[model samples]
Structure formats: C-alpha cells, structure tokens
Target: MKTRSKIEDEYWGALERLKIGKTKVVDTKSTRFRITKDAVGREAGRGKGYVRYERYPLLCEAIADAEVARKKNGPVTPSSNAKIEQQKALKQKAISDYNQLKQAYDMLMTEYLNVVRRNFELETGLAEVKNVKIIRMPSVR
Candidate 1:
C-alpha cells in the first residue's frame, strides 16, 4: 500500500494537471481527507481560469489508495459516516432554503404587480383595490 504522504502527493499532482488548484490532505489510520485550497491556480498554456478534469485521475488514485488502506485498517468513525449524514442534512436544508426563497420572491413579485395595478386604477379613475388575491399552493400534491 502507498504511504499517506505519497497518496496525497499523487492527488495534489493530479489536481495541478487538471488546474484544480491545491489541496491539503490529512490522513488518519483508516481514511484520508483532502482540504482544497481557497485559491485556484491558473490553467497551463491558456489565457485565464482553471480546469477541474485535468487532475481528476490523480485525486481518484489517491482516494483509491486510501480505500485500500481503509480495508486493511478498518473504517474511520468521526469522518466517514458522520460526514455522509452531515452532507445529507446540508442538502435537505439547502432545498428547504431554496423553497423559502422562491416563496418569498413569488409573494414580493405579486405584491409589486398589485401595487402597479392599483396605481393604474387610480390614474384611470377607478375605485377600490379589493380584487387581488394571493393564493397559497396546496400542500398535498
């Protein structure tokens, strides 16, 4: 099995080729985790920007080596299953957040249109602004 540092080197090198910037790898007995650098590096032989695919293989190989190591040394607890669960929670939260934003935006847009329509009615000498209805979507679909 490859050493942890060797695996990390391979992964970072692959990322470099792929223009994925830099990453820092932390290794425990059972699993390896990579922390990507905040800043991305520029692409080679190009004008600007970074590329992700260039270094994918390098990262994959490093991860594969880590998995092999994990098989030999058992699983890592705090970082493995916990991370999966955390990701799932984050995904659900994101969906909920998106729904909330969409609802707020819809309401605001409707109110803006209603205001405009009320202004138009006043300009055209109409009475009362009681025709607007904001309907909530049915919960069961």
Candidate 2:
C-alpha cells in the first residue's frame, strides 16, 4: 500500500507534466478529467493498478489546476465556436419545448378541474333527488 504523501507527490508530478505539455488531460465518460502520460498512453495517477483519482484531495486539486492550465494554453478554434453555437441552439430549443409542455399542462389542468367540478355538481344533484324521494315516501300504517 502506498502512503498518502507518495500519492500526493504523484499527483503533483502529473500536474507539473501537464503544465509542460508532456501529459494531456483526457475527459472521462463521467465528465471528470484524467491526466494521461502522453508518451506511455496510461493514466498518471494510477501507480500500479486502478486508482480512483477522486479519493485523494491532492489529485482533485491537481486535476483542477491542469484544467485551468489547459484552458489558458488552449487555442480558440473554429470548431469551438461551432460548439458554442450548437449549445446555444440546444438551450433555446429546450426552453421552447418547456414552454409548449407547460402550456399543454395548464390546459389539461383546467379541463380536469372543470370535469371534477361538474362531477361534484352532479353528485350533489343526485343526493338531493334521493332526499326528495325519501321525503315523498308514504307512511305504512
């Protein structure tokens, strides 16, 4: 088992390598960044086997630093602009979709309330009719 200090040293080393462009950050499926040794094509934080990078506080700090470095050094490209535009369009579409769904829900709720009101009125009318029928019943001698 490795000591905490050794693991922290590894993370700091990875961060230094990332700053110098020797290591690159790869995004995981979970949207977390992982530093990779570009020359070896393996992850930096992993010492011997699988290492959960989030377990160490230093590793998370190192990843955050690396991400900041990447953003600072990365060049703005045409593709990045296109991605921004795509995100904006998606956001607009989602807002429009939510508005439409909200309108439909409001209309349905109104109709439902009207139905319930009508049902209650009918039920009360039926009960009144039953009371009248009972009052009109002839007494048996």
Q: Point to the candidate with the largest lDDT.
A: 2
- Cα lDDT over the full model 1: 0.51
Question: Which residue pairs of candidate 1 clash?
Answer: 14-55, 18-54, 18-55
Candidate 1's clash total is 3
TM-score of each: 0.34, 0.40
**Global lDDT scores for all candidate models:** 0.51, 0.61
List residue ranges in candidate 1 displaced over 4 A: 1-77, 126-141
Error of 2 at 69 (Å): 22
How well is each residue in 65-89 modelled by candidate 1, as lDDT tens digits? Answer: 6445545666445678889999999
Best by TM-score: 2
After the best TM-score superposition of candidate 2, give how far the Cα of residue 134 lies from its true spot, in angstroms.
14
lDDT of 2 by residue, 15-73 (tens): 56656656554333333334433311234545443334446655555556666766676
RMSD of each: 15.3, 13.0
